[model samples]
Target: MGVKSDIINFPVSSCLSPTDKSLEFDRDFRIRHYAGDVVYSVVGFIDKNKDTLFQDFKRLLYNSSNPVLKCMWPEGKLRINEVTKRPLTAATLFKNSMIMLVENLACKEPYYVRCIKPNEVKSPLLFEQERCRHQVEYLGLLENVRVRRAGFAYRQTYPRFLQRYLPHINHS
Candidate 1:
């Protein structure tokens, strides 16, 4: 085997829609395509030149402005993101998929990436109340606590890249 790239930086330039919206909450690992301007560096493939992990099912969020990458699980969607105008629900990116994964890296533990809007009071100002800052804070805390039990080392890293690239998802 060739020496793996010690470090790689991938810039997510685009994102995909979905082959079928209803298929979003169906499977843990779905096939996707990386149709974007930038590319990713994946490891342990027969053809590293064309290997990529971004073209797969990921966790879905309630509302998302920036793209949130997730690890599809047997259970229902288990991911979250900030509120956005497009209002992304339990859906997956099918076309224009722009995600990347780095080889051999460590990332933060998984936590209850929840929907901030759920905790808010229904009102005309709901837009201003997208994600409750406090809720996310607690989610972070709970994630740390779970990580402790799972023996996942606590590290400060961005959620997107870490989730996509980590060899193993550090469950919290």
Candidate 2:
């Protein structure tokens, strides 16, 4: 906490954190992310951060009889007269949700189910080999396969190799 720098390093993932330099010098700040360092302009920062999603749409979705739709847009519950504070922006809500999810998953062994889209067309029974192959490569499924195949863990589908399971089969 004693460390001092022009840039305030913290959880930049959740919000647009203005560095000390940006605040003091009235200029843009550079964010060092996992991908790369990106310089973000402070021009119209306030306007851009404002929630742009329409209240009518929010109310429409919130008033939906479906519980899922209603639950999704809690901001819609506000009446024209009862409006006070600005509801969370879509980005803020998403960031908060992700933070909560990470907190919940921190103590648990996370299990992931990676889904690959078979085709761009979203057509059923249409398996796009190239698309699937690309997804497999991108997701490092090959690495997963290699890891699983380590230390004499060879996969076999041959006859006369059922000796280990024969006792169980005979018992059954």
Candidate 3:
């Protein structure tokens, strides 16, 4: 099979005239068209040339003094101002939160639970050898076994270890 070549055509200009009521001209003669959404940008609708539309949108959404926005979400407006004041990206916020979580976990006695999928078919007795091997390797069970065989895999001070394991055994 072979494809046929055909020329595609597009309109050279918009159908609406400058005097059309749908289009409005500001003091600077910048055209602002009224789409279904009341939101306006300095850039024209078709071209969307404004680079700072996101920032402008954010400002509109989080305008603390805007009566409609304040009425719609009082708490959101307050929080938005706090969030906008800080120059933090989503990645930075996520990294900071993860670091806090890790620090918190380090200070506490952590527990790990390992889960394995027995088989793809969901049969109780079906033990797939290859799948089990892959899971074991991925979970580092082999490394854990090697560490245990060599020596203590984990270390802690005698007093701290004793305190953790045997609460009744006073160090006095």
Per-residue lDDT tens digits of candidate 2, residues 1-172?
4111212343344444455443323345566642346776656543465565667788998999999778667778889777655655655554455555667778676566888889888999899998888788877788887987784555554454586566667453
Query: Can you tell me which runs of candidate 1 are displaced by over 4 Å?
Result: 1-115, 119-144, 149-151, 156-172
Residue-by-residue lDDT tens digits, candidate 1, 1-172: 2222312233333333465443332122233322212333233332333332221233332223343322322121433343232432222232122222222123434554445544345665556433555554645756777888897864565787677678676677
lDDT of 3 by residue, 51-79 (tens): 32233344555566777554433224344
Question: Who wins the lDDT comparison?
Answer: 2
**Higher-scoring candidate on lDDT, 1 or 3:** 3
Stretch of 10 with least lDDT, candidate 3: 2-11
Order of candidate numbers by TM-score, starting with the best: 2, 3, 1
Per candidate, the number of residue pairs that clash is 10, 0, 0
- Please identify model 2 stretches exceeding 4 Å from their true place: 1-46, 51-60, 75-109, 120-128, 149-172
> Which should have the higher TM-score, number 1 or number 3?
3
